[model samples]
Target: MNIVETQNLKKFFQSKKGTVKAVNGVSLNVIKGETLGIVGESGCGKTTLGRTILKLIKPTSGNIFFDEKHLFDLKLNPRKAKDILDNDGIDPKLRKSFEKNKYGLSADASVSKKGPNSWRIDDDRSTYLVKGEENSMKVYSVKDITDIDDKEMRKHRKKMNIVFQDPVSALNPQMTVYDHLNRPLVIHNMVSSEDEKLRKMVDILNTMGLKAEHLIRYPHELSGGQKQRVCIARALCLEPDFLVLDEPTSALDVSVQSKILKLLDRAKDKFDVSYMFISHNINLVRAISDRLGVMYLGKLVEIGETSDVFQNPKHPYTKGLFKSVPQPDPDKRVKAPLTGEVPSPVNPPKGCAFSPRCPHSKAVCERENPDLIEAYGRKIACHIFGKENF
Candidate 1:
């Protein structure tokens, strides 16, 4: 079961020069009780993608499904997207059309627009409102939360959370560790009394290998590792079903990084949570992730089982990333395969973003971008690999 899923996710920013595609058409999922690691270069939109999924920054367009429900679809008109609670009152023709498409619109699906106002169609006919389990006619009661009011969204916030890269800046200077951990509990009404809150905070702190006494200290009074532990404790206290760990250990010491990683591994099973671990360290991602995704210029170039991807990278960009890793034995070192600098996101290359740097660039790779095609039990976006497999 997937805890969270994104379909055609995109996030763009407008500057004086042009529109920057921070995250372009990223589609992935985090399975329940599994760690999905995402690795890429510094400006590849790893952090932006993580933040956008948590709704810290709104997405330009896409769909975010959480716990088998449509949590967000920015393109959908919330005012008109109503929850089809039951099959009762639905037009037979519309129901049949939706059934034929398997609860989603197909490319050749000829759905009429003579239904209720809630049932709307876009000009491009790429999206429709009705969706549900495959082959099941029963519709969900909760509607898409694209335009949901802040108060309503607050109810879903506890289910999703993020741990930023910089722990120092993530914590409050004036707030004590106890205050930081207790705020989420109070806001969500997770505890009935102050005593219960205190007990819960102490238990979570202990789980992070911190003493209860440390709670009284402010952020300035703690070490880098301690501060990160506090952040982890705070995120765990909410008991979120999904977490976006954005380079959680990058700012810590080498020794401390291992300890933090171990704690995170333990927390996943203890809390029954799924994670989207975003980092620049390929080795670290390989060590902790069950599945891995490689991003380039805001798009996923390759994704598959961690070990399989590391052993055999299909995409030209993914191969370059692995080759770029430093070798401890100088005698075994090999020259990196990739060349040229990354193209500016404001004006990316016409075809695949990595074509400018790829060694096997061809005329077709420069003319048109290829879709993510499945092969060898993995997904790769490159013309070198035929697209018929998907």
Candidate 2:
């Protein structure tokens, strides 16, 4: 089952230059108990996409469903359902039927609950409803959380958490290690008392190779790796099902990086959490991820099983990324590096975002953006591998 899913999710920013399309219609999924590695050049919307899905920054548009339930689906038209509600009067029998199946509105069918994210109707044309089984039953595979208010969103926060790339900045200077891990537990009421919170923090810290004594030290007192461990510990304290690991080891040394990677691997099994590991380290991604996604200019150009993608990448952009990975041998020459400056997200290229830099670019690549299509047992967004060419 998919723990997290995004459909045509977009996030744009307005600057003096223009609207920056940080994430442009990217759709992907994080499977339950699997690591989905997302790799791309800097500023390709990797971090932005992670934050957007976590609702740290509200997306401009699109749907985000967590654990089959939408973060918010507030596009329901009250007027459209008004007639049905008025005429049928939300018969007690029908209301029970809706509740029994966990479909339709909660409580009174005509009235919505306190939050804006509530599903308020059951109709054919409504965006909130997902009719299934020949439209016989209004089945909502999961709740839509698109426009939920902050208060309601907080309730779901514990289920998902993020660990930033730079641990130094992610942690507060004044806050001690214990404080960092305890805050979420307290806010979510995961623990009953101070001693219980300390015990819980110690247990999580131990898993990260830290001791109870380190909990009293502030961020400044900890080394680079220690700080990251604390950051991971804080995220794990919530016992989240999903974690957006935004380059968790990039800031650490090579030796420390391996240790942290091992820690993350152990944590995955110990805590039963899924990770969306975002990084520029292709080797690390290949080592840890079950699946790989390559992004370019704010969109995924390719995605597939890690080994298959590494052995044979379909998208030109993905191929360039693999060629760029440095070999340990000094004599091994790097293949043709991708040329041409990356296009501005504010005014991206008309057709394919990578067309300007692709070696085998054609007139079609310059005029029409290709959608991700299934080919060669993987998803590729290139005219060369598109259905028409095949």
Candidate 3:
């Protein structure tokens, strides 16, 4: 089952220069129980795509469905309530009150304030109302919470949580680690009583390889690795089915990076968590992710099982990314790094965004963009995959 799905999702930022297409026509599905890694260089819209799926950013256009439900079509059912009132033998006066209050309309002879600066009168005789007068008000025609209502979205937030990069910045300076983890559990009603909360907090700290004493210490008192562990513990407190790990180990030392990766892997099994792991480190992605999606300039160039992507890269951009990784063997020769910087998202290339930096750019590559197609059971967006040598 796909827990999350996005179809032709797009996000555009309007600036003085022009419109920046941060995410353009991106569509992907996150299987219910697998870690899907999204790897790309910085500013490739990897973070933007993750946030947009979580509804942190309102998509410019497209649809998102969660667990087979249309997220955009959520609304209070009015007809069902009418049927209940008619058949349930409820008092007619109560029904009138329910209709008036539920829909946010005026029951008596008074003006009803609607939305911003809009007003309507209940009396049949009234043609107009005073401009500045306050009237009975009700919330009607609520916009999508991803667009307007944030508090409503909080109910579903526990299902999807994100662990951002920079552990120090992500954690509070004043609060102790114990307080940090306990707060979310308490706020989300994950625990029953104070004792249970404390016990669970201590257990979580231990699972993250931190002693209970360390929980009393503030984030500043801990090392970079320890701070990251605390951040991981905080994310795990939600017990979320899907986690967005945004560069979780990017800021740590190499040695500490290994430990964090191992901890994440262990946590996945213990908690049965699925992740959308976003990072620039291909080596780390290869180690932890079961599947990989290579992103470039707000578009996915290639995606497949981890081994297939690493062994036989289909797209030029994917090949370039793999070549850029430094090998440890002394006898192995290193290829030159990817040529040219990533193109501007505001004004991407005419056709293939990576054509400027691609080594195998052809006439068709510059003239038309390629759609993401499946070949040999792998998804790739390159025109040269099945074409003859030019």
Candidate 4:
């Protein structure tokens, strides 16, 4: 079963001149215990897409489903739902609801409630948006989060968590590692006593090769690698089913990055968590990700098994990225580097977002955008490759 799925997800920020299309329209899923890596150049919405999936960035439109439940819907938080209904402005209310959802909204997953990152339905039949066969699709309207109440959103957040790109900023200088990691335990009611929390905390840290002594230290006291380990430890404290790891190892030394990567390897089984891993480091992503999605100018132009994407990229942009990955051997093919400035997100062109920079862009690529279509057991969003109208 898919742990998280977003359909036609879009998030745009308004500015004085116009809107900034940070995340245009993205559709993807993180299947159970799988790593879905998103790669793109800086400001191609990799971070924005991760944040939107975590609902930290309120989506302009689209449906986000968590473990098959319509996230932030009225059933999840009736009070927040009523509030949105009262306001009558769909966008702002859903956005506002998400802001409070992590604190204490209606998060409703019950395990026995037990085990690491695994949940057991207390009843034979859990609630569903539509009354039909198990795991069947419901009407899309029910998936909208606009009607959810703010107070109830938190109930849903414990199952999903994020470890951000910059561990220094993500951690609080004032708080000790214990303070940082303890909050999620408190929020999720994972432990009844402080000692239990401490035991679990120490165990988690130990798994990351950290000792109990480090728990008392502040974020500023730790090295870059240790800080990231602490960040990962904090995310694991919740035993989240889905984790959005946004460039978790980018800020460390090469050796340190390897250690952190090893920690992540151990974590997948220890936590049994699915991941939406976002990174700009293509090589690292290729090594770690089960599936890879290539993004260009705020759209996912290619997606498939990591090996397939690296070996047989269909889109021109995807090819450019593969070529750019540092090859250890001699540089034989000396084509000029893929060159062109990324277009302004505030005023993107009318056609394919990657057209301006594409080497094989045709008149159609400059006129109408292409839909993502299936090709070679993967998906490609290029007019030239899609099996559709030219």
Q: lDDT of all predictions, in order shown?
A: 0.79, 0.81, 0.75, 0.76
Q: After superposition, how far is residue 20 of candidate 2 from its true place, in Å?
A: 0.9
Native-structure RMSD, model 2: 6.7
What is the alpha-carbon lDDT of model 2 when measured against the actual structure? 0.81
Model 2 stretches with alpha carbons more than 4 Å out: 69-140
How would you encode candidate 4's per-residue C-alpha lDDT over 199-220 as one tens digit per residue?
9999999988899999899988
* TM-score on alpha carbons, each prediction: 0.83, 0.84, 0.78, 0.80
What ordering of candidates by lDDT runs from best to worst? Answer: 2, 1, 4, 3
List the candidate numbers ranked by TM-score, top first. 2, 1, 4, 3
**Between candidates 3 and 4, which one is better according to TM-score?**
4
> In model 4, what lDDT does residue 236 have?
86
What candidate 1 gets wrong by more than 4 Å, as runs, is 69-143, 329-331, 386-390
TM-score of model 2 vs. true structure: 0.84
- Most TM-score-accurate candidate: 2
Evaluation by lDDT, superior candidate among 2 and 4: 2
Among these predictions, the greatest lDDT belongs to 2
